[model samples]
Target chain A: MDVDRLHRRRRRWKERLMTVLIYLSVLVALLPLFSILIYVAIKGIGALNWDFFVRLPGPVGDPHAGMANAIVGTLELLLVAAAVGLPIGILAGIYLAEFGGHGLFSNSVRFLADVLSGVPSIVIGIFAYALMVLPVKHFSGWSGGVALGIMMIPVVTRTTEELIRMVPRSLREAGLALGVPRWRVTVSIVLRTAAGGLTTGAMLALARVAGETAPLLFTAFGNRYWHRSLNEPVAALTLQIYQYAISAFEDWQRQAWGAAFVLIIMVLILNILARLGTRSKFSTQQE
Target chain B: MSSSATGIPGQGHHPPAGRTGSGGTGEQPGGPLAAGGLQFSSRPRRGLADALFKAVTGAFASLILVLVLLLVLELVRSSWPSLKAFGWRFLVTQTWDPVRQQFGALPFIFGTVVSSLLALILSVPVSLGIAIYLAEMAPHWLRGPVSFLVELLAAIPSVIYGLWGIFVLVPLVRQLEVFLGTYLGFIPLFSGPPYGIGMLAAGIILAIMITPTIAAVSRDVILAVPNSQREASLALGATRWETIRNVVLEYAQSGIIGAIILGLGRALGETMAVTMVIGNRPEISASLFSFATSLTSVIANEFNESGGALHISALVELGLVLFLVTIVLNSLARFLVWQVQQRNGGAARV
Candidate 1:
């Protein structure tokens, strides 16, 4: 009886120790994120006043200045990237999930996708710079968008493929049995079933591309004024944050925090939307 | 929303055809609707569309692969002139003058390797410990939230990390550097005055950034270990710790190690953050606290600033080196994961 009690006590103690360790681990992992967020938010809030939002980044001692060019530039670049990348990514994904057979060609394409997914964004920027800018003798929004789009394609394609594959084969079989064309079956049954997931994937890809700085540094370079031309150098939130944070000026430093805050918030919102889209799809499937 | 509910023009599922494609072949053995069917009737059109789809998808995938190949080719092409001029001296020489169009990559290479090695050293053990704790000790309720938070760490942009490192981490490191230099000045690595924004600081920041990836992947692998193994170990008079150390960890070791290697890859490719905190100076040094420039950081710092053919080529060469390092790391990680999977399958067969 005494031995049994002793063993039970030891087991309980071990379990308690495990619980403490778990909490400690969680704390260590979470602290950096919390610190980053809190710091950005606190410092950034003071900088987001009325004039700061309306004005462009100007001369030294200009307290009224804001990242107006950056805000517009990021939107334009992202939109262009989506326009170029989304269709290609979605189509590729459709082909892979629906039409792919066990062949050398299919295997090679899969290998390519994996390799593309792993390649760093900086290299993509370099490639774009060499291809576009060297010939043009200019940094432009188009170059940046192209590079970002290249990075986006692999992610979107991979995610879309997985989501499409998640759609049951039975749906396609049923359509085929009803004399539906293979294309029709894929379009109607497989794609419709996976629409929510595809959207989430696209959004996630967007979130990823938005945070990139290295690619934009080379491709878009940087703009000081609000410019609408795709041929002109464009600023982005991440790039602005990079410039401001690294510059010697104190006001620029403050602006960097504000930009970082905005970027983080935007990303978090996109992430939440993606999660919601995924959850709804999951629940609908269950129903 | 309404369109989504009903699906678009071609998206609705037709009723089941009551027949299953089970027996001998995909084709029906009967004559009436056997040979080709409606899909076959539009075979030419379908064929065209299929070809178009294949072409587009093939191009998309191929473009990505080509980009990687092109990067290597372009790097080689650009660096050829410099390679011809410098011969074997480029890797050894430490000079980087743009006015005279002279350059070398030894310092950048040294800085990159040292910083990455330092990051790996610091991150691996802490990450594994976190993984073990999360996989073995965390309550069910806490697990998801903790994992989510760790993933969120990955979502924060590298620039934010750089900003934090500049404003927060460097100052803290400076205090430590002073104390260490005061106490351990006899050591060559600690002999120099700590500028704080250097290799050591960059490595520490990188370790923090990569810890989440390693921990998350390691936790997944550790959690994948079958409960039966743990139960058997416990049944054989092993404690929970002993069961984890002897049975569960041993089973998941390959995967955990692969996860660490993956994190190492991330550390190697890390750009903006490392660039910001690494105190961009182009010189080889044994001291971690001294200002140094890495391959990626050097390119980033000087690609725009460094004019002329040879300088650009040298920078591209540096990128090539980085690209190769990652490719090797990724392939190795994939192989390790595959080996682990094969081992698990073999155990199952047993």
Candidate 2:
């Protein structure tokens, strides 16, 4: 009895210690998250002004600098990326959902999408550089957008497949019973049912690509002034932040933080909204 | 919604290629229509439209495969010059001087492996702990916001992490490096001038960047472990921790490993943060404080300003290497996680 009591006491102590360690790990894991947010907010919030959002970046040591062109350029690049990525991804997803049935081809495509998602963004940058920029002999927004588009494809494809697959089989059956064509059933019934999920997925992919810096490094090849066309080098939020952060100028460093602040806010907002969107979706499904 | 339920289309099963290939012609003309076979004799026009739709969608799906093939082809084609110039010497040589055209990938490979492995080591236990906490230990109220916060961490851009790594993480790391160097002077890994922007910084920043991925995947994996496993252990009079260690974790083992491997794949490909804080010098060093470079960083930093054809080729070769390695790692990780999910009869969320 005495020995058992002692053993139990020791085990209790060990368990308590382990529990403490486990809780501490959460803190440790979240430390960087809180640190980045706190540091950026503290450093960046004070630097924000109307010019920071609207006006063009000023020369070195100029406090009147802004990142309007980068902000606009990022939006433009995203549009091009969406135009390129969404259709192919969503259509491929429909293939997997409507026609694919654990067949070898769809399985291979699924595996390829997963692997493609894992390919480093830098490699895609190189791919873009070789495929588009090298042939044109100039870095342009189009190259950057294509790189981002390629990156988005796997994410969007996977999510779109999953969402379309989520639509009840009975719905398709119901559509077919109405003498509708298979394509009409898929588009009108299946696709419509999953549209919300598709939106959320697309938003998530966009949010992810929005923060990507590596792919744009050589592709967009950031310009200092306003960019005019998809054919020309474009300023981007990430590239600008990178340029300023690495510069010797202290003011530029500050502006980098300001730009990062805007970037972070955009990314976080999209992420949160998407998560909420999925949550509501799950709740409805559960109901 | 569970994927397995809806993953199948029309419940035809994995119909063989032959059956599916001639499915349209086999149903043609409704030869001697039986009770249930083809009462309406499906219209040929509708069949054509369906075939066209399938063709279009299948063609688009094949484009993904085509895109990957194109990626491999482009990489190999562009890097052929470097391959011819370097032969096999590129992998073993350490010098990366482009001016003299001496390109060796040894240093970058070393940095990438060392830093990514270091990140895995630093992050796994913490990520597993968070996974266990969120999946099994946290009160319901705490789970929602904590998970959202973790996802928010994942949302922060890597460039911003690089920015943070530069201004915030480096200065703080300098103090740690200085302290470690002063105290652990005998250990080669810790013995060097503390630059605060070397392998150690890269590893730490990578650790921070990959934590969310590992944690989120792990949480999903642990949750996927059936409740019956835990209940059985509890019924056997095991302590909660004991049940977790012996049963829950054991069941979730492959999944957690998959999560870590996935994180590893992410770390290897990470460029912006690693590039900014890794000091960007190609060197193989035992000391964590010494400058180093990684594969992605070298590519990201030098691709644009490449000196000439050979230089660009070398970078593309490095990219090819990265692309292939990540694909292999991802496939392996997904296979492992898929195995666990198969066993537990639950879908693993990525």
Candidate 3:
């Protein structure tokens, strides 16, 4: 009886010890994320000013430099990428949801999309350089846009397909009963129902691509001056931050922090918006 | 009139045929009923429209396959010149002199493998702990917010991690190296000078970057473990910790391995953060504090400024190597995930 009691006591102590270790591990895992966010805010908040959004970057040693051109250039590149990738992604998704019949062709397409999404972004940059920059004899915003577009395709396609598949088959039957063509039923009814989710997916993809610096390092090539044409080299916020962080200039380093702050805020906002969209959709379905 | 009468009964009894015929005459092309199906005189136009839409969407779907093939072909073609010149020496040679135009992949590959494996070793325990906490221990109200925060770490860009690493992580690593070197100085792995920006710093940053991926996936896998297993263990007088350690973890072993493999893929392909903190020197060393360069980092650093054809081709070859490593890792991860799903009766969502 004495030995059994001692064994039970030791077992309880070990269990308590393991439980404490688990909680401590949680704290350790979360510490770096909170520290990084807090540090960036502390260092970056001081550099934000009206001029930071209005004026162009000054020379290397200038203390009042801003990244206005890079901000505009980033938006332009995103717009071009959206225009090129969105249509193809949505249409392909439509094919998968409506016309796909569990055949070898659709299966291969799905597999390829999965594979493409996993490819490293830097490799995609090299691909864009080989395909577009070599042919044109220069790095251009268009090449950067193409690289970003390729990255966006798989995310957009997967999300769109999932959302379209979520639309109830009963709705399609109702449209078909009313004598609507199959394609018409898909476009007018199914797509209309899935628009909100599709938009959320697109926003998430855009947010991801906006912060990509590796692809832009080679494709856009980071011009110092204001760029107006798609065929010309352009600066991007992420690329600018990379350049500033690596340079020896103290002022540039400070600006890099400021750019990092802005980029993080934009990405977080998009993520929050997507979360809200998904929540509302779920609640409505439950109701 | 005749077509309308047939359509009304056909819609009720044979919905599939009725729907097909009503959409267009393409379904009954050259059939005996073609003359009657042609009552809708715009059938030809509708048929053309349907065919056009299918063709367009199918073309777009096939484009993804073409793109993957093109990526592989282009990388091979671009790296051909170097492959022809170096034959097999490129993989074994260690010199990376751009002035002398000698390039080798051994050092970079060594750095990438060592750093990524070190990161996996450091991160797996903490990640598994977080996963278990979220899946089994956390209360209902705490699970949602904590999981969201963990996933938010993943949404943060790699470049932001790079920026944070440069200013915040490098200094702390320098201090840690001093303490380690004092105590473990006799050991070869701790014998080198501490540059602060070296394999150790890169590995730490990679551990942080990949922790969320492993935790999230592992949490899902643990949750997929049937509740009856836990209840049975408890009923048998097993402690909560014992039940989890023996039953839940054993059941989710394959899934946990899959999550680790997925994290490994991310660490190996990581470019920006690793490049920023890794000190970007081409060398194979035993010391964790020695500066090292990875495959992705080398390509990112040199591809643009390379002047000669051979130099550019060599960089492309490095890319090919990274690409092949990641593809193999990802495929293995997918297969393991599929195995987990199969074991779970196809209910595992991730």
Candidate 4:
């Protein structure tokens, strides 16, 4: 009886100990995030002024400089990425969700989507360079956009497919019951029904690629001033942050902090917006 | 974020082939699959719109397949020069002298593999812990917010982690390295000049960056184990820990391994964060405190400024290697996870 009691007590103690350890692990997992957030914010507070947003990035230690061109470039690049990525991603998703045959072919598409998402962004840079830049023999914003676009395809495809699949099969039946053409039903009823969720998912993918730097390193190939055309090299917020972080100047490093902080805010805002959108009635509805 | 939301009913809830494909073959008119009477409804005439829609969407789907195939072809073509020049020597050779135009990837490969494995070792336990806490222990109200925050860590840009690593993590790592070197100097892994930005820092950052992928995936897998098993264990007089250790962990083991391999793929492919703090040396070392450079980092640092054709070719070859490695890892991970979920009676929820 005493042994049984002792054994039970020991087991309870072991359970208590492991529980504490697990709690600590949570603390460890979250520590870096909070640290990065707080540290970058604290370091970047000084650079959040209007001039920091308005002026061009100056020579190494210059105080009156900003990432104006980079900010614009990032937006421009995103626009290009959206143009290249959205149509193909959404259309491909429609194929998978609406028309894909349940066989080896559709399975491979979905499988490849996972594989592509796991592909390093750097390889995409190489791909862009080889496909677009090598023939042109120069770096350009278009290549960077292409790289980010390829990266976006899988995420956008999966999300769109998922959201569209959630649209009630009964809804589809009703549309067909009205003798609506299948394409019309898909475009008007099904796509429209899931539009909010699709938009959020796209936003999440955009948020992810917006901070990409490696692919742009060789493809977009950072520019100092405003780019004249899609053919020219473009600056990206992420590339600028990378360049500045590694530079010898402390002032440039400070700007790196500011840039990192801005990038984080952009990503976090997209994430928050996506979550809110995910909570929209259509998505939160019972499957 | 969709995957991160995880338990949100419709988010990632659909299997790719679960309810899809009315067989899509336009030849089947008003047959078995046409019962829904959607596109294949009996009609007086065959319609162009339906054919066109199917054609266009099919074309787009086929394009995805073609795109990946083309990407591989492009990589092979671009890396051909280096492949021809280096032959099989490229994999095992150590020297990467750019001036004389000799390049070998042994060091970068070693660094990438070692640092990633180090991250896996350090992170899997912490990740599993977080997964267990959230899936089995945490109050229902807390799961949503905590899971979101952890996944947000994954979403934060790699460059942001690089920046933080440079200024924050490197310094802290230096202190730890020096302490370890001071007392545990006898061990090869701990003995070296305590350069702040090196293998250990890279591993630590990778571990932190990778924790979310594992934690979230494992949490989902564990949550899917069905509560009845837990009830049975509890009814059998097992302690909560015993139930979790013997049953929950057992049931979710393969899925957890898949999650870890997925994290491994991400670690192997990660570029920017490692680039910022890995000290950018090209030498293999037993000491984790030594400077190192990963395959992706070497490509990032040198691709734009590569000296000549061979140099660029070499870097592209390195990228090709990285790509193939990640593809293999991710494919393996997906297969394992799929196997378990298939047995579990459905596709996994993300």
Pick by DockQ: which candidate is best? 4
Question: How well does candidate 3 score on lDDT at residue A112?
Answer: 78
User: TM-score of B chain for each model?
Assistant: 0.83, 0.88, 0.85, 0.91
Q: lDDT per residue, candidate 1, B36-121, as tens digits?
A: 55444554565565456456666665565566577678767877888788777887888988778777878888888788889989
Which segments of model 4 are wrong by more than 4 Å? A282-284, B1-18, B24-46, B347-350
Candidate 3's fnat?
0.55
Tell me the lDDT of candidate 1: 0.75
Tens digits of per-residue lDDT for model 1, A222-261: 8999776999899899999998899999988988998888
TM-score of each: 0.89, 0.94, 0.92, 0.95
lDDT of 3 by residue, A100-170 (tens): 54578876887677777778889999999999999879989999998999988877777777677777666
Error of 3 at B107 (Å): 0.6
Give the least accurate 10-residue stretch of model 4 chain B, judged by summed lDDT: B4-13
**Cα lDDT of model 2 by residue, A1-287, tens digit:** 99999999887888888899889999998888889999899888877899998889999877788999999999999998999899999999888766775679988898788777889989999999989999989999999999999988887787777777677656665665566776888899888888878888888889889999999988999987899798999999999999999889999999999999999888878877887788788788766
Whole-model lDDT per candidate? 0.75, 0.83, 0.81, 0.84
Highest TM-score against the true fold, candidate: 4
> Tens digit of lDDT per residue, candidate 3, span B1-350?
00110000000111122222222224432223435423455455766777788789889999998999999999999999989988789988998887887888899999899999989998999999999999899998998788878777777888889989999999999999999999998998887887799999999999998888788877877876778888999999989899999999998888789779888988988899999999999988889999999988999999988979989999999888888887787778767755665576645322
- Between candidates 1 and 2, the DockQ winner: 2
Q: Rank the candidates by DockQ, best first.
A: 4, 2, 3, 1
Screening candidate 2 with a backbone cut-off below 3 angstroms (N, C-alpha, C), the clashing residue pairs are none
Model 2 alpha-carbon drift over 4 Å, by segment: B1-42, B347-350
**TM-score of chain A for candidate 3?**
0.96
- Clash pairs, candidate 4, are none
